[model samples]
Target chain A: MNRRPTLWLLLSFALVLLLAFACQQFTGAEYFIDSSSCNGCGECIRICPNDAIYYNQSGKAEIDQTKCTHCANCVAICPNNAVY
Target chain B: MLACALQAQNAFTLRSDAQMVIAQSHTGVAGLNRMSWEHHFGPDLDLSVSSTLNSNDRIIPTNVQKLWHNGLVDINYRGTDFTVHADYRNTVFGASQLLGLYPTWDPLTSQKRLMQHQGTIAAEFDADFLQLGGFASGKILRYTPYTLDLDTFELVRQDNANATDVYTGAVIKVPIIKGLATHVAMDYKSGTFADNGEYDLNKLNAGLNADYKILGNASVSASFDWTKRTGAAISNGKTNLLRSTLRLRHRFSNSLAGYLLYINNSCLNDRMKNLRLMANYLRAQVQYSFPSDPTGGSYLLVGGKYSPENKADAYFVEGDYKVREKIYAGGSLNLQPDWQALISARLSYYYTPVNELHLQYSHRQYTPWNNSSLDFGANYLGVGTSFHW
Candidate 1:
């Protein structure tokens, strides 16, 4: 009949649920490469862990949508600021 | 005359990288060699052809040596407001899980023999205030594992993880203000496995991004993505994933800069009892450089990660120093719960702008989170050289 302990446990469970909900957000974004700004350095291709990036006919870097795991490795490695 | 014109318009490069790796069980030599030729037909059109060869036995845990190669052809056209590009690649290689940020928990490792042919095309149009782009890609993968057929008195290729994947996506971006921009994109992906239809899957992803510059020297960007996957192989035949990232970058002074990044990954409406993917990661770094020397710089980075579902926490610290103009050294230490740690050091000499000689050493002590008795340690020493012209 320790009501205090039950109250504490319930409060802790509520806090955990609140934290989980707060962490989930709808603020995610998509990534793309600006073809005009791309300089064909191939750095993005080399750093892609999933092998999602490749060169297109115009010699510019292009990302394969299916293979891309949305890791954003290409966006971080692009030197010309082409990836967004 | 034609040969001279072609030679004048073409640029050729050949690069070779060789590393001698010393590991506990074996001492192996890994090599990568590439040759590429690019020719500019005009200012707006270009074509390139490249070939690469690789031989490495140290990537996988086993000692089964393998050599592989790939060839690529690419072409591009850049117009005033529109850009078009296409490429094709063919590769034959042995695939394995290379050493990465996350340690493999399973001790048994096997290489998969694979051959792949991929083609992609993309186009982008810049409409002054808004940019729009779309791309489509297709790939075919063939697995090559042969077994002796007792009935036919011949060899038969076993059905393995062969699959074809198709992906298409489109994105549009709009600049709202001088320092603000937003974008929305969606993509569709499908995969068909040859061996098992139950493993086939289709995925759809939609995401949004916002970027803003706070001041002249600082910027902030955030993104959120939602993914829906459906397949018979998936747990409960369906799943939903949500991922988000926030990044802040600031240039404190002429010689000082830093950045902070945070990521949240979660699976919502989770019904699978055995699988859960939820984690939060945070990383911060500060860099300082000598004002007078462009090449002299140093940085310190620290990161931490937590997984509520798995009850795991990981931390890492990485730093580097220029030491001098031509010599540089760096080291990193990573620690995870259950006594898992990795420590690595690297030193490099830059002889010229496009040439480098380096030595790297790493030692890893790994213990599975669920199993403590399977603990093991590995040491790696690599000496490599690279040159470009």
Candidate 2:
């Protein structure tokens, strides 16, 4: 019987995990790439060992973290300017 | 990536909404998956492939090589008044240990390759809250090895066949109450398997789920799946499996969430062999969007899992950070206590069109009950891309 009560406690616990995904849907810290700030510095591309940093036709570098290895190479490489 | 960097020029219409990834494991397993393909040919075609590169003493001789492949295709259409889709995938892999090169273990002898193919196809339609689909899948396998024993190439396995499965299912979604929705689905399957050494099983499954949005950030739901499989070699004679899961989500604040989940599974066969074999896992994780003043979002997760069959229970803690929308990282540390403690880290690059290069490295040292230990490790590095044009 004591273990039965513990089930409610455990169920309440799992609900908490998914709340973050729902919460983000509301706070909506939307981010859009501002290609204007880019300075044509390939440093971001070079530092990203995983090749996550790339340049568009306009020579502006962008980072896609999903492909990023979080190796801090790009962060360490950008000299003039870099975001993400 | 270079193509994406070339934004202003003539470039492919890389579906920013598509998710594609290529992964490889040292065990000669490699995979490329495109969840939804927005093809240059059409907006409705999805393509994916998973393949393998095998070398070494695995199913071949010294320096001999084998290439395995997996592919997928999906066609989807959603007009203003109609919706229809079909998805198909096939996985083919080599599974064989290379026998010694020859009678004398010749180093220059030719190697052999063993392989198998598995495939599945599903077609569905969306009308109202009802969906109807049919699926067909199968596996064909072969294993043949040749040794250069003074130039004698011999056949290994005499019989290597396969199995096929065809299934049809119906799904219905209904709003039960104001804040609750119920999903019910049932599938009937016909399964067949060959190759005397392998296991063959047939089964049917039915699943139902209920989701209720209680308040804004909190909801509770329950789900169940039941499958009845024909006895097979690997089944230990088990014929049926039933699993049930209950979940509750609570978002107390922007930075914190409390989730509780419970799962119960049962397998029954001629007798109830693993009737006592049950699995229960409990975990609570934290999500933190890097402060706006900062750069990105990071999630810290810690959880516990208990499987009855394991020698004992184990505890795991993991943390992941997505700081730059361009940088991604996660690490896991686990403890089996008096038994072992291990840690692993993962780093990834983010690419638009949901495809990019990936590099991963992990190490684990196994501690024996006798206090002796062996170190095990795996590291993977590869590049993959998905393009619609």
Candidate 3:
């Protein structure tokens, strides 16, 4: 029988986190959100891990560009696609 | 941050893919380029940069190019209950360049289109069991070229409005018990419009999340959230929203599992003609996952929606399989209570040089919905890919 060593399991967790930030190299996909087309629905804000979308005094939702990781959750959730 | 340190020890991951399809006598070509660079500067500092470029061309209409860039330099300052960070970003959003090519398209010909605009910012902060941020940003919105519809007297440049909005907020998290947490956030924003108008808003939010482990492979989660928004602009508007969701999940074994979710949402949309909109939906699904395979999972989804004034019902069964490591495939059969059955599927590939190329093709029949009367029948095909780095 074969089983992974504990150290291997540790490395696996490390790799998953690496995949989170270091694996963005997939480019040229038709996957950008048009922010202007977005209605102030906050679904994407709730889906974000970074808590990046906020209100700009105009009462509309805004994304914290710095905190945004370009994950495209905003694009996927927007039925009107104001985010791309 | 740990990720940056790990990836820094490796280098040279290059990937790219392109595809072209001609269907329904319509030709389209699309491609993707994605890359990332992560580096660690010291014990407390790390940086990561990511970018994506997407462009598509429709033979007669629907041509578009969307480009985005994001980067962050995180300063990890260890704290008792929070980690502090600082990030900066620059983004350019433009869709006019593509819409400009399709002059004869009725939907866009007389409508508003996005020209070009940029959003830029830099911020620094500190935290402990709580987070707060303050940043400066500038935005520009350009009107799309438009033609007036004289008969309708509708002056539409698509949506000719642009503005720069500035705001900041903070989040506070509190744990009530094991596997339970509560959070509260507040935000304030100001917007300046190009049409000689402005808006200001203040909002308050609170939410709670809880999870219970029923067994080794089963769990239940529930959440409730409420928000209050008051806007002082064009017309004074005040609204409130309450949303909640509950889900139960279980895995029968290493290859099968299921879940059921219930959602309730209520809102007062001042723009909904003063009618409070309430929507409720229930979704349930069961799946058989293919073991020893990272790409195959089959599921049956049944769900329905109910609004204050109408109802909708649907059911679907779908299967996901990785015919090849680089190739992924899935499809579904859907049935509506008042419409024809819908069928859909796709085959997609994840390409690599030393590995086989991935490809996906899917066709789906869509059913339309009407609160007054349900009538439906539509179909579409989508083929796309994601390259690795």
- Candidate with better lDDT, 1 vs 2: 1
| lDDT tens digits, residue span B304-382, model 1 | 5443232334566776676787776888887665435678898878686446677888776655542223224566677
- In CAPRI terms, model 1 is classed as incorrect
Predicted candidate 3 versus true structure: per-residue lDDT over B236-341, tens digit per residue: 2226554565677898887778777655544434452332324444556676766756334333333332221222335657665666545556666655443235
The prediction achieving the highest lDDT against the true structure is: 1
Number of the top-ranking candidate, with TM-score as the measure: 1
- What's the TM-score, to 2 decimals, of chain B in model 3? 0.61
- Specify the CAPRI tier of model 3: incorrect
List candidate 3 stretches off by more than 4 Å: A1-84, B1-17, B23-25, B37-48, B59-80, B84-162, B194-198, B233-238, B268-275, B285-287, B294-356, B364-389
Per-residue lDDT of B110-188 in model 2, one digit per residue for the tens?
3333433334444555555555555444433333434334445654333433333333445555543333344555544
Instruction: Locate the minimum summed-lDDT window of 10 residues in model 1 chain B.
Output: B99-108
The 10 consecutive residues of candidate 3 chain A with the worst lDDT sum are A23-32
Q: Considering summed lDDT, which 10 consecutive residues are worst modelled in model 3 chain B?
A: B370-379
What TM-score, over all chains together, does every model reach?
0.63, 0.52, 0.55
What would the TM-score be for candidate 3 when compared with the true structure?
0.55
CA lDDT of every candidate:
0.59, 0.41, 0.45
Against the native complex, each candidate's DockQ, computed on alpha carbons, is 0.05, 0.02, 0.03
